[model samples]
Structures are given as structure tokens and as C-alpha cells.
Target: MSLSPSTLSPPPLSLYVHIPWCVRKCPYCDFNSHQGRGELPFAAYVDALLADLDLDLPLVWGRTVQTVFFGGGTPSLMPGELIDRFLQGASSRLRFAPGCEITLETNPGTVEHGSFKAYCDAGINRLSFGVQSFDDGCLQRLGRIHDSSEATAAIKLAQDAGFDNINLDLMYALPGQNLAMAESDLEQAFALQPTHMSHYQLTLEPNTVFAARPPSGLPDEDGSWDIQEHCQAMLADAGYRQYEVSAYARPGRECVHNLNYWKYGDYLGIGAGAHGKITSGHDQSILRRWKLKHPAAYLEAADSERGIGGDELIATERRPFEFMLNALRLVDGFSLTGFEASTGVPRSAIQAQLQEAVQKQWLLVDGDAVRPTALGRRFTNDVVELFLTG
Candidate 1:
């Protein structure tokens, strides 16, 4: 794979702040989140996060952040004052684009009536609730802290807090989940009238307790397919369009921060266990970086040179696979020119793979745009792998 000087401009820049503490670690969670114990070191963590951002300021100097996402163990668990302070600090340190979308990930069980309003007042325009399932039994099996009713109330509370752009995170194919149960969850979610929803399939990831001790009664492949088909229909009927594989939203309600990611844009990640991608104009090379995973460890070294866990300049040979890994997840796909612009690799490098995909009817390329077919979207991994060198 021969790399050439990129004539394309840099993509949009975003910010991702990770909060790595949760009330309780779920059995199937593989995120860099730890179970909360005793009082949280809220002030210390906030200070460390700001300092970490300071250390990374040079890489993104003068660049306006289009969006800011507070993701993690449960960002809503933090005190409202702390959230306000963090946002204030971030605003002071960086320039935000006009009407920049700021999102906070919260859990229903941790939300307080007054807190939601405070968060909104503090400049959070979007809220994503981690309401994994609506069924109490499924919630228990999944080790979620909130029940169905609390999830419902949380959305109402967010609405009352002046947040019109809200997203509900729901999951299907849980332990003992059938078609009816899946539909029931979707029905409850749709009833809330949320502007956006993230419907995900529950997978037992490696290193999770569920993977170690496999749970019984999980839906089989055929059963999971049935649940997905029916639930998708329900969402479409409710006017929620599927933008990404699992993300659905009403018109103009798609998550801007996530869209930047799927489009292979740039982001600066701060806080514990956060990952970031940046493209340098100096050499036209892309670099990936991450912070330390453990909160205590990250805090201890927040201002030190070793604060970063690791970073690497993406090898020229691997840019194609890396670009496709994210771009191909979009239903509308990407353009050939955009692909070369983002990866800094010529189209000739992957021409063979693109032709092969079209021959197999997995991709539809008409002129400058390249989109995945229905079959391609269904077996996205296979389509993406076509570009992999090894």
C-alpha cells in the first residue's frame, strides 16, 4: 500500500470524556468501568481530567470542537455541581463550535429530578439513558440497576428538564428473551417518544462474568434474528430511521458525535481509558492514542509525561482496513473520494477488493458514491474483511 500526500482537508473534530466509575459493574460489561465503592473522588477526577486535556491541547490547538460526549460507567452518577464545573473548565480551555452538541450518558437509577435540570442548565443539550431492557426479569439477569418503571420516569424527567433531544439505549436478545418480550421492550421504548434510540444485541463479551459462566436461555441465532426483524419493523413504523447498525433516530436527530466517529473524523479523548484518533497535517499521517485504564493510575499520572497509556501512528498498509471498519457500518456507505481523502491511500490500492465486492453483489458503486447492499449490511464484517491484507 503506497501512501500519498493527502489533498483532502481534516475531518470534523469532537471531544470524548470518559467517566470510569459505575454504581455496579454489569456481568456482561467490558468497558473500562469499575464498581463504585464508598465516596467517589469527584473533585480529584475532574481536576485530573482538565489537566489531561491541557496536556493534549497542543495537538488540537485552534480547532473548534463540534461536539462533546460524556460517556462511561455512568456520567449521571457524578454530582450536578461537578458536571457543571467540568463543563465550565472545558469551555475555558477550548473553543466550541456554534451550537455544539454536548451529550451526557446517564442511568435511570441514578437520576434525580433536580439534577437533570442542573445538567441542562450547565450546557448539556443531549442525554442518553442506559435503559438496557424494560422487563424487570431481564433487567435482573443483565444486572442492571434500574427497572422498567424508573427508565420511563427518567425520560419524563429529562423532558421536564428542558431537554428535547434525548436518546434511550435499549438492548434485545437477553437471557430468556423471546419475540414477544423483545417487542414488548420496543413498545415501551417507543411509548416514551424519545427522539433517538440505540437498539443493541446483548453479546457475552470476553472477560465478562457472563462469558466466564455462560448464562442459560440466551436466544439462539434464529431466535435473535426473529427478534431483530420484528423490533426493526416496530421502530420503522414509529418513524425512527436506522442510521447506523444499532442507532435509530427521528429526522435530524442522529448523534453528531457518533456520526463523526463513523465518518472517520478526528477526536480528542480525555479521562481514564479514553481512546482518540487524530490526523496530522504536518505529515499526513493518522495517529491513535489512549489514556490509562484505571482511574487511580490515570489520576496519579495525569500531569506526568506518562499519562498516556500508549499511542501509535497507523501503518500505511493498515489504513484501508481501519477506514472501512468504521465507514462501512453506515447504511448509506461512503464515497470513493472520501475514502482516499480520509485514509490517505489511493483507490488503486483497494480497487481489487472493491471490484470483488461489487461482483458478489455486496456493494453498489455508482459513480463517486459506494454503498453497501442489503446483503452487505447484513454481513458487514465479511464485506469489511475484503479489504484486509492479512
Candidate 2:
């Protein structure tokens, strides 16, 4: 059942658990998040999450989970006890690597009454807070529930609770946000001294409220680039290195779970709207599976085959584009040998595309290592499109 001639080896495995409920959905968010009406079904959702994982367990039978991330809607909303219960069940079914980086994405608004210590005790070593901006007006414009002070207090609370490996999520080029306001946000984040930071420009995603009705006073392309350039310089001066396009980290603090993803590793994604990518050595093939998106429907179908929303097998021709989509995002880029191992396709398949990119000064192929040039990184889409159409 192999699709390509290149030998394939499974990479590090991670687990992604998606929580679909949020107190209030942000207008700019395009993720599969829904606003919670009343009390959320925490207990029932935990049960369903475990059930979903059970169904997907066979895909990685003997594999050890190298990392675990509880991504959200607002994972901070789920109480600690239930998270502990889910971890217990999962560890029993599959092996977890020692000192695995288990992260929970926290909404600053939701963490106001939450217990960070309880989460720490539940084996969550890392916390990523959604603190989009330090400007209250910008926060309001983005429909974020947490104001500037709340975001600061939330990080302090996590810090006091002994969370050293914290990540602050920030966005720039918001409505009514100027270069100075964006600098202020970075300054505030630097004071927190988080292990990592995810900084990116805010764009209107389709189907979202912002996209349907665009926000007023949004920064133009040049303005956004100015903000990005200044903030990146500030981050570097503050000891945060730009590892990926949007991700920055202190030395040795890069997110392991996300690194696995960037390296085209294996992962089991369970919970509503969660997507999983697995590489099977038995068949030398790759499988991508996703669960039902709606919480209610996913809850009802969790323990059954009906929970699966869709599955896609990677065709031999599509491997290069798929591999480049993740691999090319890295600053250091990937090695030729690593590419073949991950994609199960020979390097010769992409030689023409590689040569073209090199000739155009878009990529630098130094021996076995291939990395994007500054010009290419700026036009990453165009560089990736070469492989897409190859």
C-alpha cells in the first residue's frame, strides 16, 4: 500500500486535544471555536475526549507520545480534575515520554477564576495564554473578552502558580494599533519573561465576522510590515529568537509539540474538530483524520465510528507540497535526507523545483541542507508554489 518509492520512517509523536467551547468567540478568530451558552459540559466532554482517543489509539499502537497539547476554544475553562483523569486514562493506554511537554492553551479571561496550581499538579508543564494585545481599545475592537490588565494578571497568576514554561500569544497590526502600541505590547510581554511568544500580523480570515464586515482603521500592508519589523527587533533584543514565522522562544524553550509538527512528525488529534496526521511504517503511508466539528454531534458520536468526520490518504504526487507546507516554515529549513524520510519520496522528484528556486536566489542549497533565502522567506508562498505545481 506504499504510495512512494522512498523509504519512510515515523517521526516523533504528539497528542493534540481540542476544546470547542469559548466564553465569547472573538470576531477575528477563524478556529473551530464556538461561544458557550451556559455551563459547559466539562465532565461529559472529558468522557467523550477519552472515548475519541480510544478509537484512534490503534493507529499508533507501540508509539510513545512525545508531547501533549490541550488546544482550545479555551482549555483553561476545563477544570483540573478532569484533565488529570484524561491524562491518567491516556497514559495507561499508551506510553508517554518522560517529561513530556503537556501544554494547555489558556484564555486570559477564563483564567481569572481558574487554578493554575491544579493544572500544574495535573501534569501540565507549559501554558500558552491568548493575550492578543495590551491595548484595551484594540482588545475591544477584536472582541476579546480580556482587557489589558486581565491579561497581565493572568500571566502573573500562572507564574505565581509555578509555571515557568509559559508562552504569550500576541498579534500586531490590529485596528487602531500603531507602531508604538505594538511596541508597548511587546514591552509588556517581555516583562512577563515567558519562555516563548507567538507574534503575528492579524488578518481577516474568511467566514469570520471580521472578514464579512471589515474592521475600521485596520493597518495597511506597509504599516503592518513596519510593526512586524520593529516588534521582531524588540523580541530579539529581549532574548527571544525567531524560530518560525510567528513563533519566538528563549534559548532551549522552543515548543516541542509544535516543532514536531513543523518537522512533519506524527500526532493523534482527538476531540471535536481535532485533526490528526499519522505515518504507518507497516504500510509506508500517511493518514490524516479529523473528528466531527460540532461539540454536540461529536459528543454523541465519540465512542462510535461516526465520530470521524473525514479521512484522507496522501497520494504520491501531493507529498512534496504537503511536506514543504510545514518544513519550509522553519528558519533552518530541512535536510534532504530528512525530507525523504518524512515524505517517503525521493529527493530527485523535487530536484527541478529545487534547482529553479536556487537559480532564482530564492533558496540556498548548501550540500544536503536547503534553506530559504531572505527574499524567499519574504515570498514563502511563491517558493512553496513551485513545489505545489512541480
Candidate 3:
């Protein structure tokens, strides 16, 4: 069953531009990132991105993008001029809402003397630094190119560049990491005074090098849980609220682009290996699309119909599970009306699951809003699994 247009008037839109090159690939990273060969095809890639957006323009012609995120592989590695030109091209072709939160992801190793300032001047209002750990030993163990010093310097440089809205990415439960080490890492990160922090536990994802040859001294489940709990307490005491599972922010500093994503809003994805979701106005059908993964193949098909690797109409039966996959990540959960509007799946569709979850002490349903209880947040996977259908 398809959704009626009246019930799906569309949600706020965002834009994601993927840059698929990195100095070196991390052992645990499974993102679509290729190590830099001799020189990056900056000009060709930018042109291809614009062409890709042009092809997707019809799907979001009249909509104003509320946020733009330049993610992956280290977008800061690109020259500031190319970044500026790409944003200019996107602006010329699409409408950007006033005060749009434009973000760029970078790593500590990629920072040059003036690159941060250049990117800021190019209209990137927010910067997310990939500072996996502040421990030099852990950094080396993780195969990270940047050391603890570089990570510290990078945050200082971004602050000096006049970027107040900065996010530091830190990881816990690393190889040989103990509770004290985790606390020290968080202390170092907090000392830098970043507006937002994404504290993630390092897990060996499938198809990655680490998953094949696991590292030694990796923390067990109990150790990992201890590290997470202590660090979360430290963050809370320091005035950073845990808005999502791994994301913490000071008041009014939560990532707008990510919030839109967690809310199941619409976003246009361009560049190699980027994924996008759109709610079509014509029929109110929810569609998910993606581009070619390899840079060469993506560039070759940029202007062709094959530029899009695949597109599919999300089945109505699957919409509830899909929506909960993202929405349940939030600590506050979601409202029934918002969920219905975003997924076009009525409350009744998931009523049985909700009732079961509440009975299992995994969720608390208070009138219109349904949120995970403290126990539910701990076993979020189980809570979300309740919505799945056979």
C-alpha cells in the first residue's frame, strides 16, 4: 500500500556530499573510503558531484535544504577552493535555508597550517574532527595516522579559525584500553571545550581488517560497559547532555544535520557511495537511492542513468522497522504523530510491538510520546527488534 500525498507532505531536507579518499584506511573502518593514490582527482570529482546533483534536482526542486554535510574519507583534504566551488555549484542549483548548518568532516592528520580557516571561510560553519583517541599508544594500535599531539593541535587550530561549533570524535574500548585510560581520554577531550562530542566504542565491523585478524587485549563486554558508564557520567557532569546513544552536546549545539537524519527527514546524497532518502510529492512514496561505490565507476557514470547504483520504493510493511531503526537511537524516543508522518505507517501497525515492548519493560508510552526506559536504552537492539516483522 502506498501513502497518500496528504499524509506525507515531506519533511525538512538536508544534503550530503561524500568525499571518498583518505590518506590511509583505518583497520576497523568499513566505510567506502579508498586510500589516496598519487594525487586526488579533485576537479573531476567536483564536476561529477555537481552533475550527480543535477540529475537528482528534480526530486527536490522546490525544497530548501536546511543543512549540508561534507562527510567521509576526510573532506578537509580537498583544497579550500574546490570546496568553495562545490558549495557554490550546489547553491546555484538548489535552495539553501537561511542559517543552514554546513559541516565538514576532517581528521587530525589532514590538518594543515591554514586549511581549517580556509574551509571556514568557504562557508563550512561546523567542523567534526576525527580524533579517535588521545592516547598515543591506542592511536598507534588503531592504525591512526595522527598521534595525540596532532589531535590536540587540530582542535586548537579549529578554534583559532573562529569555529565555535566544533565536534570532537573520540573512541573508547580500544585495544588494551582500561577504565582509567578511557577517563583520561574524555578528560583531555573536555579540556578542549568543544561544543559537541561523539564518543563511540570501537567495534570490529565485518569485512574490515581488524575483524579478520582481531587485535589483542580488546576489552570484553563487562569492561566495555564499565568504560562507557564512567565516561557517560563524566560527560554529564561537564554539562554535555547525552542526546543520542553516542552523541553528546551542550545546549543548542546538537548536530542539526544528524538530527534531521534521526528524525527520518529527507536528504539528497551525492558523490561516490552516498545514500539518500526522499519522500516523493507526486505519490508520497518513500524511496531510497544510492550512487556507485567506487570513485572511478561513479565518475564514469556521473552523468548517466547508471550514476544511481540502485533505487527502491520502501515497502509499506517495512516502513515501521526502518523508521524505528533511526528514531530509537535518540534518548527521548519519538512521538506517535511524528513517526506516522515520517514513515506513513499508522500507529496501529506497530501497536502490538509497542505493547510487547512496554510489557517487557523496554519502553514507556506516555500519551503521544513513546520513549525507551533506562533498561531499553541499554538493550536498544532488542527494543528496536520488537518492531521487526517476519
Query: What RMSD does each model have against the real structure?
Result: 0.9, 1.4, 1.1
Which lDDT tens digits does candidate 2 get at residues 1-390?
134544788989999999999999888889999899988999999899989998998899999999999998989889998899999988988899999999999988887535798899999999999999989999999999989999999999999988999999999999999999999999988888899999988989999999999999998999999998889899999999988889999999999999999889999999999999999887888999999999999999999989999999988788889888888888888999998898888888899999999999989999999998878888888888998852
Model 2, position 187: C-alpha lDDT score: 92
lDDT of 1 by residue, 106-173 (tens): 99999988999889988999999999999999999999998899989989988988999999999998
Clashes of each: 0, 0, 0
Mind giving the per-residue lDDT tens digits that candidate 3 earns over 1-390? Answer: 345346665889999999999999999999999999998999999999999999999999799999999998889889988999999999999999999999999898988758987898889999999998899999999999999999998889888988999999999999999999999999999999999999999989999999999999999999999999999999999999999999999999999999999889899999999999998767868989999999999999999879999999988778888888888889999999998888777787788999999999999999999988889989889988887876
lDDT of each: 0.91, 0.91, 0.91
RMSD of 2: 1.4
Global local distance difference test of model 1:
0.91
